[model samples]
Target: MLFASRPTCIKRLLVIEDDPLTAFDNEHTLKHSGYDVVATVDSGEAAVAVIASEQIDALVLDLGLAGHMSGREVARIARDRGIAVLLVTGQCPVDAEEMAVACLGKPHSAAALVSALKAVETMTCKNKTPRKVSGLTTFWRPEAA
Candidate 1:
């Protein structure tokens, strides 16, 4: 089990979604929700580039991206770099529990997004996993010792 403690409250976000409308919605929602949107990119390549250069706190990712690199790949890279992930997808991957702080399914509301992110903060910072949060599948990590 990994014991490293990353900052639980994510302030800066990188959004990776190919759909123009969804991307715009996510960017706008996150910004209005008081999260700094570092960049909104459609491809994992661009996401990776931003990850390399920016001090991003989290990645809001979509599964069906239009590029060679998949969302899973980007999530791995982000996690490796100590960035949290919040997956917003229609088809949640089987291994999402391993890669993301939470999986927020598609057709979700803004309230659900913010709530799930707050759950993330609770889990990571407080080491308390909340149960049955709406519109999200929160992940688990071993408590840091």
Candidate 2:
């Protein structure tokens, strides 16, 4: 089975999470999946700074960061900057309309993360078309963004 790979230029990602163990695990998984993680910040403030400085392709954000700024803030900034976001959090009840990023529930599988990342990449593509999976929706385009 030859699976399609995401765009090569957009391989960098940022991770914002308060838990070191989960962050490490996620980093390892993303790296194994061929993503170049730019940084791992424990707070949304730090994440904002890193995002401002680096050319991040995507963000794996945790809503409950240990700072005044939350992942929602980071996601908002990313959306404004046209950077994609993947929100990972427990059931804390976020306003879907407030978030322009993909939301993945806690304790999600690696396959789900990969799928979300791929969808985000596809959405960021130049075409901006949405792809429908077996029973899920994904924004995927073959054009460059």
Candidate 3:
């Protein structure tokens, strides 16, 4: 089924998760969900580097990555650079009103992931939200800023 997105610009996404299985799942799901996942990295440092050097339009970021650099840090960098971010985690949610467009809790469905991303896309473009899904929380962010 078709999703809500700009017809011409397939969102260029990046996936950042430390868990091998989750990372693989995210990439596969996103690819099938009509998003162009440009890269998948497992650390904050690598995520930072990819966002800096590539044309990444969004990030599917998992907090609690095993590293000195935190997922929050990468989200901030992406946010500052006008890249959309959707933070995912099972632990305590971070204070991310400015740094991310949405927060998706763990143990979610592929449909939830797609719906959450579509919600973020619509919210960013139209300032309107879609139907809320379980485990998905959204926040307002300035257009690409």
Give me the candidate number with maximum TM-score: 1
Which model, 1 or 2, shows the larger TM-score?
Answer: 1
Q: Write candidate 1's Cα lDDT for 1-145 as tens digits.
A: 1212333467888999999999998888777777789999999999999999999988889978888999999999999998888899996789998889889998888767767776777776678876566778888775877
Candidate 3 CA-lDDT value: 0.82
Distance from true location, Cα of 14 in model 1, Å? 0.6
Candidate that scores best on lDDT: 1
- Predictions ranked by TM-score, top down? 1, 3, 2
- Candidate 1 vs candidate 2: the lDDT winner is 1
| TM-score computed on alpha carbons, candidate 1 | 0.88
- Measured against the true structure, the TM-scores of the candidates, in listed sequence, are 0.88, 0.79, 0.88
- Angstrom error at residue 10, model 1: 1.2
Model 2 spans > 4 angstroms off: 1-9, 92-94, 126-145
Pairs that collide in candidate 1 are none
lDDT of 2: 0.74
